[model samples]
Target: MTRNATSFPFDIVLFDLDGTLVDSNRDLAPAVNHALSLEDRPPVPEAEVRNLIGGGAFAMLERALQATGGPVAQTRFAELGAELLAHYRAHIADNTVPFEGVTAALDRLAQLGCKLAVCTNKAEEPARDLLAKLDLAGRFDAIYGGDTLGPGNAKPDPAMLYAAIADCGGGRAAMVGDSTYDVRAARNANIPAITFRYGYHDVPVEELGGDAMIDHWNELLPTLEGVLTS
Candidate 1:
């Protein structure tokens, strides 16, 4: 594709679902706690759950388990993970919401001819379900989740990112996310990444090594433009 300096800088903008696009921990924490409760483990505080995000349900649950006690057996852990997913699916959007200005930013991006897509470590079914409930699914050309390409193909691997771009019909692309996995995937895919400071990150957002970082959705477009064009 030919570059058009005056137009939007990227043909597609890939986003991470949990932290980057929506504040999901409000709902996620409870689901995690639900699983922990099944194991007679103490509940993880919602505030602290934010740090446990990024690696997906299993990882988050593992972190929660580790914090509360210790790791469970593989069979038991899988069962708890299943329980967590069931609870999460039932109440996925109870308290989850797009961060302020997300709608407006997405609108502006679409108007600028950017094809939006999601490349998340979340499983595809629930990710789609969550976005559909939020009325945000229609805005994206594609939504490639962790399980989309089968097991062992989630972010930080770059497989899903590449798949999302191809499914979006491939073009100049950039990633917008809030975790090391996201940034690492973007790097592996040779795309610039813009990190959101307000999203869940285990490390300091600055240490994630994104091409740029923004504290709000209002800063997204301009920051992305700068990253992609300069």
Candidate 2:
């Protein structure tokens, strides 16, 4: 087989799992709400959960508390976080679907010889399972889970981003994700990052400081084409 670097401007197109590829947050919101309810807290809205996402479980939980103006307690939060993860695991694949044009976009990238991978703050089991369910499993050469290696492998840190680069064979690579966490990870890893306009982020897309900002998944194709062919 030919090397991925030859034909694609980026050898690998690494994605952020939650908002970028799949709507896993629908399942996540309910689990979080259930956890909150268990703690006698008010139910959280999905919009709140959407905004709280992208930083993995710990970051998400901390942000969720801040969003609701609830004092964050680490010990209590850990227990509640476990409950949320349990609930989330039970319904992980339910209601999860690939974003519009994702398959087609990936198809074009593959046809153009771009290797694909996933770097998600999601847990490995569910992240890997969701991709398999969406038939996007084989599409990626690797999946970097938040808990896969250890505590700090999650997004906004760049560890997983660097890992993905290594997994894709260590040449030209690009990170494509929807959140500021994703963009930050890419920038920290010293890889070019591209942000999707429509994905969740605490900061504005432009403020995330990605190499490029794209509003649609289909744009990935032409953008990548320009990268390699330029």
Worst lDDT 10-window in candidate 2: 1-10
- Largest lDDT belongs to which candidate? 1
- What does the lDDT read for residue 5 in candidate 2? 39
The C-alpha local distance difference test score for the whole of candidate 1 amounts to 0.90
- Please provide, for model 1 over 1-230, each residue's C-alpha lDDT reduced to its tens digit, 9 standing for 90 to 100: 63323477788889999988999999999999999999999998898999999788999999999999999999999999999999999999999999999999999988888888999999999999999999999999999989989988998999988888888778899999999999999999999999988889978766988988889999999887776578
**TM-score winner among the candidates?**
1
The whole-model lDDT of each prediction reads: 0.90, 0.79
Q: Measured by TM-score, how close is model 2 to the native structure?
A: 0.90
Expressed as tens digits, the lDDT of each residue in 1-230 for candidate 2 is 33573545676788998889887777888887887777777877887687778677767776766666675568888898898888888888787788889999888877777778899888898788878877889988889888877987788888887887778777677888888788788878877777778777777656877777787888887776675346
Using all chains and alpha carbons, the TM-scores for the candidates as numbered come to: 0.96, 0.90
Clash pairs detected, candidate 2 = 9-228
lDDT of the structure predicted as candidate 2: 0.79
lDDT measured at residue 171 in model 1 versus the true structure, 0 to 100 = 84
